[model samples]
Target: MAVGLVAVGAVVGLEAADRAFPPPLAEAGMVSAEVQDRDGRLLRAFATPDGLWRLRTQARDVDPRFVSMLLAYEDQRFYHHSGVDPRALLRAAFQALTHGRILSGGSTLSMQVARLIEPREARSLGAKLRQVLRALQIERRLSKAEILDLYLTHAPYGGNLEGVRSASLAYFGKEPRRLSLGEAALLVALPQLPERRRPDRNAKLAEAARQRVLDRAAVAAVIGAGEAERAALAPVPATRQALPTLAAHLAEAARRRAPAVMVQRTTVQAPVQARLEALAASAAAKAGPRVSVAIVMADSQSGEILAEVGSAGYLDSARSGWIDMTRVPRSPGSTLKPFIYGLAFEEGLVSQETIIEDRPADFFGYRPRNFDMRYQGDVTIRQALQLSLNVPAIRLLDAVGPSRLMVRFRRAGVRPALPAGEVPGLAIGLGGLGISLRDLVQLYAALANGGRPVQLGDGVEGEPGLVDGAPLIDPVAAWHVADILSGVLPPSGSRRSGIAYKTGTSYGYRDAWSVGYDGRMVIGVWVGRADNGAVPGITGYATAAPILFEAFAKSGVGLTPMPRAPAGAVRLAQAALPPSLRRFSAGPAGLVSARAEDAPLQIVYPPEGAKVELGTDAAGATLPLMLKLQGGRAPYRWLANGKPLTTLSRRRVNPWLPDGAGFSKLTVIDARGRAASVSVFLQE
Candidate 1:
């Protein structure tokens, strides 16, 4: 019965083999090839359906040492075998049966290549017989050198790496040709158990597998015993390279735009990218758990983004896979103030010397206060901007009209996120509208580049404007705004000042911003909690300004002072005395009389010098000068030659009529008891 059953089984197996026999396997063809930049280095690979993960070709010449080591460890008789080795298969089958599980693969290099090229669905007993038949067919059709080349170029080692070229780069972080003997052995050992032999995940197991390759190489006489020993003992150069979080983000972005088939050529510079990564890493390390940082660096002249750092580390749980914060929109705080001011200047609604009241005022229920809650009563447009006085900015915003400012912002590439039907108010000047850092940087660049709005894109040229001929704003106005901004550096309190900048804090300190430009570069910085919570006791001037200064100072971009305004483009004037000093007079004997209060105040000469005689006919004649008081009230008393005259009400001054050529002193006492005296010459 047993003999009959064996005959039946053998007959059935023969029948199954006959039925399973299909057409001989053809050589695996290329599928898709992808090229990408890894940490600024270019890498290319080919993907095949049935091979490892992807197949990659050697860059130029195959590294003979790597090939020799792989052949020695994987298939000692690879050169002599025709696709399949019967003797090795019998030995492997015996070991598997005794162990009750498969422990080794006795397939020759050609058989492995067949497995790689053919579908795994063909792995049945009958399928294995077919694979053997196909192996014989492949050997008959291709030469030994061709088979070796196909195997080396098409086999998958691990992790999206199809061939030895990619495996060399992925595993050892070096080219195949540059790999050392031990490194080559490491690659050779990985294919047998790719997952278990990953160096990053299983160092000990990988090391053990590496030793197995060394042992095999020795047995095959691929290397001398001493050489093999030395190679095994050599340090593995154990460093692992990982893509930084920011670099990874950029890579992913590049991949998205081009996919696996198209190669991406970006404007990102490797050295600049390295520096940006370092800066982001340092910032992340310093910021700790609560804070995350994102940075974007671009060329001011060309608007080419040179570098970008998205986060501290790619694997960081808190920030990993988050949308790039640098590109996202957030409340710009005071960073938007310059644009508003620039618009006002361009429209001829205000100038650097224009007086702006900085006192407390409400605009449509929104009352903007200075960061310190301190008010400056009256200041020039230049001083208000330099000091970042909130009240003055709010007043200026009201004067310039919020709708008009919004139009200018849109023209500059900033799409403000203000609600429709929302009345523009003082808050608008304080960056109440949402804006992106990219937009802010571009706006500032417009000012730096002479009023030309930069077209923000990978390589698109900005439209020709006032600077470039499209005329978004008068180049002169933009230049004037730049001049005012250039004086805002080092903060109002810092001793070192050379930068024109503006600082802004959002409601509750959720965001802080410092945006500024020199002749050559425009930079904007934002500091805040990623969660949109206030940083206790921090403001734009205190937080973002320092960072901006550091970036510019370290960037090696020299500061070029903005061009000065023409001789008569702007002028300055001091506030006049209070109304009480308008009328007061000095007597003939150099005495000031109480009755002089009714006399009209006038200047016989300018301050700092005077000549007068009370009896002179010229002295009795009225002078044309009059007193002008600024925004406050104060008491005043007039004196001639150290004699007290009549007390004058706010802004009240007495006129002086000179009689003959002589010098007379006039002293004016303020409400605070402060006195200023001047002498005028009485000329006939």
Candidate 2:
């Protein structure tokens, strides 16, 4: 009765001690932050706060053979024992006592995991007893599988690497899901003396350690002797591989967003990201030490950013590579011209063949000149855009209110940065405003997706999806712009990619940009110093366009044909165009005289048999009729009912008051006596 009472008291005391000191299970939650591709391939990983590469690992993520080998080598009775194996411990103690030295520690996998969670510097008996007690507590709280997971996650593998996954990736350059016999054995033997037998630093020791695991596995009948011999012949990796850093910038950004999440999944495709990263690095090296490159490739239909190269090299100090140029707002130069033309097309102000003057022009004190300082006398609307003429774009932007153009841009899921306290103006069409490469890509994606705007996501923020706003432009107008841009000739020595693209160069050669798209994918490239410093003689056509074409070639995505012409979209010849669309003229505010080379004279406004409204003001005086014409020889004559109402005029616009509110005929005769007449009913 006394013995039984003593035993019960000891048990009660042990239970109270266990309750007083619970295991630090929360340490298991501190794992390395990882950024993975859509398919779960690691793009980049940031170390834990303690500077350890301790990735979270699960038994299912490792090869079954490796797991079996680890169990067999570390703890033969792992499945049978709750936390400690008595038979193994007795044998170790007997051998140590008989030999007068500690030959084996008799530690189970659970004890090893406990030590990993709370490491101790001394190998004293007290430390061992503490580990054994912690192991018991761990087993009571966690299942066998969870304990194994902790071991797999916290097991040391030399240097800063902790987890089997990090070790495997570093030594073998692949995942642990599919390891060879030799590789499995090596990994099973690593955690025992990780630093002394590191494959990268001590290949001979690593090989010897692996051989011992193989020989033991054979003797234990886990593998045949013949198979062990074959596995022994396999060579150990002599060097450690640098882990994947394909999307470094994006990975860092994702970590900042969700610091607590162990693994952050992105929409990035690993293959595409790898290829573009290589391209950006190579391109930057060739460009110059100070020049940096940024590229963004996205799906127009899904709005997913397949690959985003934020800089030429994330660590290139000369190029300020840490800056994410894709998101940095800078002058876009002439890249915004297409949208201006599209707005004009949507407003029925011009057609593809409309003759628009590219001569130097002024808009409310803002004068925009051609890039070459020489203008194409009177080019078609298509030619003006294909040539990237500055004056023509400003003219179109002036006609279609700049504020309206900005509204369209907002529909495309981006708001361009305007100068402080300044309203949208014509200079914006000439690269006066700032926009990022991502914003530009989003806008072009809308153009490629038939004017339907899509909001892009880089897997870091959210899924790429369609925007709820209206289309950026009408389908017909978008098609017209695509048709014109597609006809733009490729850069010298480069083959056509069958994609619609545009190029731009900011003022002072600060930035060169190229954006292109097929039916499905859109890519934008920027070449400049990240510090916003100028690189002389750098033009978009000569520098950025080639990179754009090369990216399309190397992106590994098949070309999706541009969308077919939408309803109401047609390429009209100059002669077949509507009178208004045949020749584009700026409003009275920014109009310039038409040269003799302009299209034949014709009255654009007040189409034949149309009603004219001339409402009176508060003064009750008759308001004069405003007549507008398109092309005409200078010094034109205007007549009402065969009577000359005004002397010969050099301007295409004229005003007249009808004798009374009734049917009237108006005629315009140019210097060549070529007359075009329009009849209309007047109403007050």
Candidate 3:
């Protein structure tokens, strides 16, 4: 009797010690990284650090119907019961007495949670008592809801699948937030014998198990008899479904941003992302082998990224699809032409009606030719930009100074990549430098955003825009550019209307791009071999433009044109323009004597990126800006921005009056398209 009393005292002592020091719960807490889209829908899930595909879920992430079915099928009085059910225990005892053997295993959901947390292999009485003790201990520590959450998160579903979210994705290829009656019943039945009744392993056994749940559902009045019968007939999944893997590139980026974080919310809309991924895949297949596609869609109002597809296929080896092409630098053909024209308009150097010659021209031994090797001879500034003429754009770039354009891009948060040790040259006007699709889209978005730049991101989290700096360009210039682009012909068979778009084909056909924007959104697309090798016969107009149009169509956004013309935008004809603007008349301009061949061409007046206000004459009329000559060939053809002046003279001295306020480019082509330029701010 003394020994028995000592044993009871020892048991009490052990219980006290157990309560004083509980086992750490973190041993079972490994969870996968869950990347969600803008609406908080899971975009993709990565395995745990331990390489397990466990996505631990809370009770709220699951369908209420699923939770109810789980409780009804597993434990009827789960809410009322503690660690162990006395009524169930007594019933098991009565059945054991009648049958002279153990009949039902009377384990509450809490006891199962205990087993899951502290597993034991032996089925001995000592082990059973230990499980009961652990359950009671756990009940005292966590609330009923928390205890249920532990079960919902850790319960085995099948094959590497644990928890309802992972199982729901593996079986139904979706979240567990919403489930049909049949789906709920199957999930409820799986945890009983996860591996044994795996749908992929044995559909018959899985279906049979699911039917048993349906039978119970009818008896418990959880569902009508007809509903139960239909649920029982619902076919079980024959194989595990693939998980959500959209936005793979963004998924990796988010992971890198917060490596230790298990869940990351990114700036992407789930539906648009999914459709763009599908469209990318389709474009790749049709573009032949070794070809890949990249696309970006952003909101102009807030600069939020709606969709970004880095490649056609993340696992496609032939196309080097793992590369994030949106961030990659490639030549941006005529995509920068609109910006060039916009700057000219801001400077009042030229209006849309100012005539410019598109003939072959040379500057400092560098001759410029059109893409098709044919010249339009004479075209207005509006026509020149719309047609993307090489010579005219080069003349504008020469005057604007390529470096100045680069500075404007930087202010707008974009940087184009240039060759090592190479200076900005007139070639840059015709796709000479490299710019990423992402940066290009951001620049175009500025035009749609009324000359302001909205930082690109998912709006769930704030992405800061330009830090209180001046707008990228004058609103009137931006408006004019948008209006001109809106009139550019759309690709064949495109049903879209009113999208201001531009197409670009890089040198050697290495890259093709089509970026477009409406009043509120911008989308940029790139099609090419990710390896940077040339892909012949694929022009931006033929390949990438169509994809861009289709992407906007599938994006479910209404098409809106650019906002109304900003203040200072004037509608005038060639005859209505001022005498100085009536006809572009640029004289031969030089920084050195006409006979000085050793000196490189340079701008003498209105220095590079200089802000110059108009000087008034005796009559109070603005005096012309003096042009000095020094180097290069005589009879230089001068241009204000891209417009050819009516005069081509051997005399070095030239004159240009300020027509308005804003930025302007002044260029002088010395026989060759090889030219000298300066970007100056002209003020009235």
Candidate 4:
């Protein structure tokens, strides 16, 4: 009875000690963060706080053969023992006594994990005793699988690489999920003396160690004798490979967003990203020094980014590669012309074969010229857009109103950056506004997906999904745009890729952009100096368009047919077109043959400096005010407070809605570009 009491007291004392001084299990959670592709392939990995490449590894994350080999070599009775194997320890002790040396140190996987958790420099008896006790506490707190996971995560394999996953990536350039027989045996033998047997530095030691594990496995019948012999003949890696760094910008962004997340999964495809990055680098190199390139490829239907290359080289300081050019706002040149034509088509004001003047023209005070300083005189709406003519686009923008275009862009989930205190204007159609490559890609996605805008997500911020809002343009208009763009000839030395595309060059050659899309994918490319410096001879068609074509060719995705035409989208010949649709006129009047004899434009009603009372609705809201005008020509554009009204009017009587009771400056421009203004005090 006395002895039983003594035993109970000892058990109570052990329990109290275990409760007071728990193992440092939190240390096991300090692992490196990883960014993976859609298929869970590692894109990049960041070191831990202490600069160690210690990736978290579970039993399932490793090859089963590796786990079996590790158990057979490290601890034969690992599962049978609670923490320390008594029979193995006794045999080890007996062997040391008989051999007069330490032939083996019988430490179970759990005890090794405990030592790794709280490392000690000396191999003293006290250290061993502490490890045994800690192992017992660990086994009591964790299951067998958990214990194995801890061992796999904490085991060392060479300089700065701690864990089987890290070792496998560093030495074999792949994950530990599917390792070869030789690779698995090498990893199983590495933790015993990681530095001494590092394959990159001590190749002979690593080979010898791997051979020993294979021999032991063969003797224990864990693997066949012939298999062990074959494995033994496998060569050890003599060099270490760097972990993947594809999508560097995106990976960094993801890491910053969720710093606490151990694994960040993105919608990017590894193969596509890798190919595009190489293409960007090659393109930039061919372009010249101090040149950088950015590319973004996404699915038009789902809006998921398949690949995004932010720069030519992530570490090229000469090209300012650290900057993410995909997100930078730069002049968009003539890329926005398609949208202006789209709006015109939606309003039924123009058709593909409609004749439009492309000569130098003035809108109020803004005069736009063609890109090559040469005019095409008169060209079809399709030819104007295909040629990227400037004056025709400005005329279309003036007719449709820039404010309406801005609203359409807003509906597409993008807002172009305007100069401070300035509103959207005619120059915007000519790349006067600032937009990013990503934003441009998003805008073109609407055209590819039947006028439905898609909001793109970077797997880190949000998700790619269809947005519920006003259509960017009607389905018929969108189809018209696709038809015209698809007919644009490819650049020299490039075969046609049955996709619709457009190109733009920012003013002064500061930015080059090309955006293209098919039914399935949309890719946008930008090439220029990141510092916004001008490249003398660089133009979108020459610099950016070629890269775009090559990117699509090398992207490994087959070209998908463009969407078929929607209802009422038939392309009529010039003769068959309606009288109004046959030729685009600045005014409702078909043409003004003599402008000198025309009456001067004037607002007859609401005479200058007059106060007018506005009628209010039942909800106490001010109603639109009617203003009459006797104009120089038909088709007058009205603007109040520097904002253009939604549509052009040919009836001379136009309505203006006041936001509230205030003085508003109302201006009207006639077809001959004649303008008149009136300031009226409006009161409800």
lDDT of each candidate versus the true structure:
0.60, 0.86, 0.79, 0.87
In the range 1-684, model 3's lDDT, one tens digit per residue, is 999999999999988888786744676667788889878888889987656678878889999978877877778888897789988878877998999987766778888888877777976678878778888888888899988888888788877788888999999888899998889999998988899989888888888888888888788887888998877877888889888898888888878778888888877889999999999999989997999999999988777898889999999999898899998999988898888877667655568888767876667666878878999987888888888788887766655555556656766877677788665666777888989888899899888887886667653334835435666777988888888888888889997478999998999998999999998889999999988999999888899999999988988776776688877897579888865454333321213232344345555555687766554433456555655434566668888869976587664556666567788888887754458888888765
Q: Which stretches in model 2 have alpha-carbon errors above 4 Å?
A: 1-8, 97-103, 224-226, 587-684
How high is each candidate's TM-score?
0.58, 0.84, 0.84, 0.88
Tell me, by lDDT, which candidate is best.
4
Of 3 and 4, the candidate ahead on TM-score is 4
Candidate 2 residue-wise lDDT, 1-684, digit = tens: 999999999999999988899889997778988999989999998888889998889999999988888877889999999899888889889999999998778999999999999998999989989998999999999999999999999999999999999999999999899999899999999898899999888989999999999988888888889999999999999998988898889998998898888898998999999998899889888888899999999999999999999999998888998999999999999999999998778756789888887776556678788888998888989999999998888877765656657767877868888787666667899888889999999999999989999989987875698988568888999999999999999999789978899999999999999999998999999999999899998889999999999999998988898877988888888889766566776533435355332567667556688665553422456545557666766678899999998887766545677788889998998877788998999876
Model 2: weakest 10-residue lDDT segment is 588-597
Is 1 or 2 the stronger prediction by lDDT?
A: 2
RMSD list, candidates in order: 17.7, 7.9, 8.3, 6.7
Q: List the residue pairs that clash in candidate 4.
A: 333-431
**lDDT digits (tens) for residues 301-328 of candidate 1:** 6665555555545556664425555666
Shift of residue 598 alpha carbon in model 3, Å = 31
lDDT computed for candidate 1: 0.60
Q: Model 2's lDDT to the true fold?
A: 0.86
Per-residue lDDT of candidate 4, residues 269-355 (tens digit)? 999999999999999999989999999999988989999999999999999999999999999999999999998887666899999
Model 3: lDDT equals 0.79
